[model samples]
Target: MFKVEAIADSYDQRVVDVDTGVYLEWLVTGSRYTTEVFNLVHPGGMIPFTTSREYGVDPHTGLPFLVFRFITFGSAVRAQLRTKHLINCTFTDDLAKKFWMTVAAEALVVFGSAYNGFKVPNRRYTRVEVNEKIYTLEDFGYTTSPG
Candidate 1:
């Protein structure tokens, strides 16, 4: 398992609530990346944001954060990854690229040309039996260095 970490805004100040300022920062960052990534997708669609996002709570722990769901298609594969939990994050430059790359890889995995219409042939990936269905970047070969 990889220890994935990202810095996020606290949205607090000494006197007045700085939520607006923090949100605005995310908005600006999100807008910039939205355009850049959209260009890369080119005729594809996306709705990623630096700060603007749909909020949800963890079913078990009730931890809340912004969510950006990505469904990607690569030349050989197509897969979707949800649950890149951006908790008070500004969609930092590094992580935004990471997210984009991760989804692209997943799409390749799902496409199965690499695996030849099956799982990775060498058993490099291990499948687990879980009641809930979710795709992890690790399964598609993404690991984060410690912060």
Candidate 2:
């Protein structure tokens, strides 16, 4: 419910193309392209946190999650929050960013790398060919070395 409303309210509206021509001496223009899909079902926005539930203590043990097993308009929900995926934080849809990031870090660890700040990677990303392009890590952003 909240997810539907949220995406409708906020989405990606990008300009694909601008077509301009003279139609009957009148200028006709239009834009083309595609679409907002935000993983914006955040901690508190969609699913309620501990403070949002009936009581501070979670009705369902462990982390909270959205229940999509059954969709019932008037059905009674035992617990406002679901803790099914608490063991591993897989409740949200995300790219393999975490896993890939760890792999990238391994490169830095073995070869060693520097940081911009105390322990911050560089602002720019590093684009390199890996495994003969079969397993390339494109635009490895947040690099430690500038040059």
Candidate 3:
């Protein structure tokens, strides 16, 4: 038999904890979006890192001078973005990821709702054609996503 409660809980947990870090970074960079846009990815619940500025180290000194410079540049970009200096702007990765997260949350609800009124099963049925043909509502459709 399957359990709907367990499946709904598991799906809910996955929806609540999916990570949006990489997605957010991509959104900010104005990159092409991938199908991973679904809400069931990593970290779950709440946005992960809000920003993702990369850094580089020198081959000789192994220092992060390049990274520091990049951070400074990012700060300037952020300021410009906020001050309306950057108009007709595309959504940042973070914003895009957030958008997807919202979409995913909605999808999760739909997924759960699809199973409403399903009854739990107490026994397993063998994979036989005759068995299936003779089964009734009370005898089938109770397996949940989660065990």
- Sorted by TM-score, highest first, which candidate order results? 1, 3, 2
Residue-level lDDT tens digits of model 2 in 50-142 = 101011222554432211111111111322223232111222343443332333222322221111111223221212122323111123332
- Residue 13 of model 1, lDDT score: 16
Q: Best lDDT goes to which candidate?
A: 1
lDDT of each: 0.28, 0.20, 0.27
Query: By TM-score, how accurate is candidate 1?
Result: 0.23
Alpha-carbon shift of residue 135 in model 1 (angstroms) = 3.8
Regions of model 3 farther than 4 Å from truth? 1-92, 117-147
Which of the two, 1 or 3, has more lDDT? 1
List candidate 1 stretches off by more than 4 Å.
1-37, 41-52, 70-136
Weakest lDDT window of 10 consecutive positions for candidate 2: 21-30
- Each candidate structure's TM-score, on Cα atoms with residue i matched to residue i, is 0.23, 0.15, 0.18
Clashing residue pairs for model 2:
11-36, 12-36, 122-143, 125-141, 126-140
What lDDT tens digits, residue by residue, belong to model 1 across residues 104-138? 33432232221121333322232221123334335
Q: List the residue pairs that clash in candidate 1.
A: 30-50, 77-107, 77-111, 79-107
Pick by TM-score: 1 or 3, better one: 1
Using lDDT, rank the candidates from best to worst: 1, 3, 2
Model 3, position 134, has a per-residue lDDT of 23
Candidate with more favorable, higher TM-score: 2 or 3: 3
